[model samples]
Target: MDRGEQQLIDLVNAWAKYSEATPDADVAGFCLHYLTETAQPAVLNQHSPVASPDGLYDEKWVESLTGTANRSLTEIRPSSRLAALVGRLSKYGYFYSKKAMFPLNFKSIEEPVYLIVLAQMGTPKKSELIYEMMVEFASGIDVVNRLVGMGYIEEFPDENDRRSKRLRITEAGLTILQECFPVMNRVADVAYSSLTEGEKALLIQILDKLDRYHAEHYKLSKNAGFDEVYDRMVT
Candidate 1:
């Protein structure tokens, strides 16, 4: 890995240790330090976190620091800084999710498949649900196929388009998620407890910004049918 990526991985490992030691500290601060430190300025001043009066960080600033464009931070790129951070968090999330849902093993069901199924059951609209998950965690068709093979989910013909399909989590999948709900909640609590209230809010704000930005840009790319945009970006 490059220095920046290595630093991020190291910071995440440190945060994991810190969470175990001081589960009520400011986790957001720690994560922000990781991102901002590797950022272009070499040393991030207070102004770095605060979006400009126009409500966005300078494009050149991001590019110079991260060796990528500001647009990369949005949906255009799969491996943006925020995307990498979220990917790491999702791996952590999947680990916890699996731990929570253990003992009811679906040998063929991968982490991404489980996550997608969980999303479908939680949200009403399949498209919206998939979009939300994509924003929070990216996955591909191969993962979905595995879920189908495992009988955890089924794809039905969309009423509007026979060629397209909609996903539904099977009863078995729902049962697993229901059993795991409490444990998953605890996992979230454990993860978030590492941050103070202020730090939690700040981290939420930063993530929300990245999520929204990506959603918008993702839509644009989809409209243009730009499939290859994410080909080189996944971790």
Candidate 2:
């Protein structure tokens, strides 16, 4: 057997031992963590460890590894349960946001824009707000204009720069928020209704970590080469 095949066998054996030793350890997650933490440079450079030239050479080795991995853990692969939960939550959010805004004459697009304007009240420039919200400039401009036309948001010329405008929520907007926020919050409460307070806190902590990592580490520049740019960015 080749060195890579031997390594795979050894790794699988080690995982089997560990899983047997700790019945409650998330075995699938343990496997994924091990693979990620101990990933070799060759695998990093090549992208796929299992499909690499040095990896499992034939169906027999693959079957052997599979059997070994499953001996201690019914599921040996990573799962999408978290992602599926998020997807379901997204649908709930969409439905609730639409329903919550119906009374205020706010649609899906306007609801988010209104919330952003309400939060920013007096400080950030409109352009900065749009960029922070990660929306297209033209689309954001339209929403801002609509909000202004509705008298929910007021704009003032930036004192620092006469050419730019700063946005703030008006009394009308504040009143609307006071009336609607509790209802909107109820929608969120419904989404997490099944989770205990402890579970909610834990989920928030985990999701926050993911959010920070994704925002800081997963950004890609359109101009840079794929491998070099991404490797340097994440590293």
Candidate 3:
């Protein structure tokens, strides 16, 4: 429709072609998946102090914005699968690229606030390690204290020990996410509109497969070497 939408569509179609030729190539997957995974941590560390234990950027939000209407790739016939896949993959790419382009100014809030929020939101309520955030990106406590002062987050009493506290997303914090939705959706539309329906589906399948694979192997892959590789590829 608009120039941005056209650019996104062209990008998705190109990526679909690239992925079809190299299904197992980890470079593309690494680039896409890393951003997908890192957005939560980056957002936590850079934005507000909301820990997204489930993951960064809600899946439902992604699907709704990307026009994926709750249907799995397998459910679609081969003729239309590619288009759907492309749309989804391009959407993912657009989301992280935009965030990377417009990184939050963490001068006031510590950079690790986003990661702390992510850790709090993660399943089982696990506290994300400061070391892990350092590996993701170097951060400091002054920034963290600043975020607390700014009202983006509030302290939660740790269930295990009264002496400790964890961070939780406040209603205001959720409002930030709500505000971001339209910008993200606009980016996705720009990334996937050029393709025929079939090409888009293929892109979605490839990315979904990559995501599943990453989820399965994330524990082994969460090392410094992997982080370096990801940073290099994405940049």
Candidate 4:
């Protein structure tokens, strides 16, 4: 068989696998699925957007790049590209979240998050809140103080540790959180609107995996030097 026949065979195989994996079968997303899975270096130009609501990939565009398959990720430097994209996306996340939060009286996304965590903990010691947040002691205390002053949360002396205080989300905090949930969901929707459900699920899986990986090393490497941290993490 010719190379053209072999490419067709591979494409069909990808379809079969995807059809099996997403039993409901994301037919529209298959275009991107093929491109990404095959890594076919087709120029996703101004005309050919990388992500589309419809998950469209052009067949003629694929045919135009017939000879590019032999190329590899080294030319693209996928890791660096991923890192840069993640950093830029974080800026977008902060921008949208900040706008959505203004009317709700949240200074940042961390406020609602702190309330949620404290609520779940059912009156945890202040140190425990800091540990759960993985923030510096001073930074965590600042957040706690702001919440206390806003009447969003309250802190009382910890009976178990006289020197430490305990914290709980106040009724006002819970009320604000209830209001914030739908608004925050809208913010998330704006961010993820371009992705198909299959793509969203895949993104969640990838991000969750990364979160788990970092959570394991977070405490152990907290105070370590850059070289020590990199060596420990990279290996």
Candidate 5:
């Protein structure tokens, strides 16, 4: 067949795959559904059973494929759609943020501790940053060691918790921040440059709400619908 016919067949095959049906087994069903919903009146009025132009296929062959696509979509659409959209949002954020960091020449995951140390400015113990950065205790220790070795930060025994250590960005770290922070700020500006100030505030507010909800409830909510999960979390 020509391009149009081949493309139509390919499109139906794709929908079958998306819906998690075997294309060779279920294609006729997908095609039948597509034609029923979208075909012209003349096509629908045809006397003979519908088939590929090669006459190797027929509408009856697709009879059981009916609603397979809808059933698949119904089962997965809610979670899948949210995952796809939110995943892209996170992916692009990381993409731009990485591009922002390229000039810093410190691409290791541990490098962010320098910025965190500067931002927190000795208000928090180095141990506490493990939770703040959502990393393991050992990981936080490793990063802190790396920063200390780099002379970008200095750690001191916490007065209240003698076993714990608080961190402060050294003058050297501040010097590096002078070079790096502007690049981060510029990248952030480009990333959110589409939003108005009000929209930015609103987005932050909404994200805070989502972050809190998910942080508290995501483990409990897995494989469960939102209302059921929320109810479980509340009770």
Candidate 6:
């Protein structure tokens, strides 16, 4: 057979095997499977916990999470499990980033982040900056006050509205923020060290989808109660 015919036969055989393994997967998913197996053979599949590309999770440990026993994962839905992982990862990232920021005279990551945002905003109203961060008014005020006290940022009266105040990063803030970029990069490096390039790309696609969803909902849910938000967004 010619090379083109041979390749076509191989694709058919691969599709047959892939359909057998993943009965629910669509043609698009099979195309990805075929490409992953043939074109990008070095990049391992992420389905099996045993075959985790990072090799951080132990197969035996993963298999043990079942039944009505203590610490069992039997009742946890995939969404709940994923949420828990996201929470834990956020906490871990906070820990590393906290340590990373401490040397720059920042008590928390918020200080430098506020300066960075203000710098990007080129003098935003205090409320505008706060809302951009999605923080409570009091908490945002506290950070602003601390930054003002530290000489990292300054507040000025708005030209149009004398009663309104605008915020911007100062020279000192710029110096410190320049120093923080590399440290924060290291923190990110540690967080993403386990994932391969393909995995990272795929994860970014999934996370960006989630972030866009939440960004819209956060605005609507700001004044809403838990049940009110849940009923509207979830059930």
> Which candidate should be chosen as best, given TM-score against the real structure?
4
State TM-scores per candidate.
0.45, 0.57, 0.40, 0.71, 0.50, 0.69
User: How would you encode candidate 2's per-residue C-alpha lDDT over 1-235 as one tens digit per residue?
Assistant: 9999998898888788667867676756566556556664445445332333343334424443434321211122223334544666777687877887777787753554555555764667888767666667898778878777878788898999999888888788777777776777777776677899867876776688788866764345434687876687555
Superposition TM-score, candidate 3 onto the true structure = 0.40
In angstroms, give how far residue 179 of model 5 lies from its true place.
2.9
**Which structure is stronger by lDDT: 4 or 6?**
6
Model 3 agreement with the true structure over 166-194: per-residue lDDT tens digits: 66656665665554456555555666677
Best-to-worst order by lDDT is 6, 4, 2, 5, 1, 3
lDDT of candidate model 2 versus the reference: 0.64
Clashes of each: 2, 0, 42, 0, 0, 0
TM-score of 4: 0.71
Judge candidate 6 at residue 48 and give its lDDT. 31
Write one digit per residue (lDDT tens) for candidate 1, span 40-142: 4323333333323343445534553454543323322323454555666766766765665466553322544455455656433346445544533245455
Q: Lowest-scoring 10 consecutive residues by lDDT in candidate 3? A: 104-113
| Each model's lDDT | 0.57, 0.64, 0.52, 0.76, 0.63, 0.77
lDDT of 4 by residue, 138-222 (tens): 9999999989999999989988779988898889889988998898898888888889998898788678889999999988887
- After superposing candidate 5 on the true structure, give the runs of residues whose Cα lies further than 4 Å from its correct spot: 1-80, 108-114, 121-123, 160-162, 194-202, 212-235
Candidate 4 displacement at residue 88 in angstroms = 1.6
TM accuracy, model 6: 0.69
Against the true structure, what is every candidate's RMSD?
A: 14.6, 11.2, 19.0, 9.2, 16.0, 8.7
- Of 2 and 5, which scores higher on lDDT? 2
The Cα error of candidate 6 at residue 28, in Å, is 9.8
Model 1, runs deviating above 4 Å = 1-90, 95-98, 106-139, 157-165, 223-235
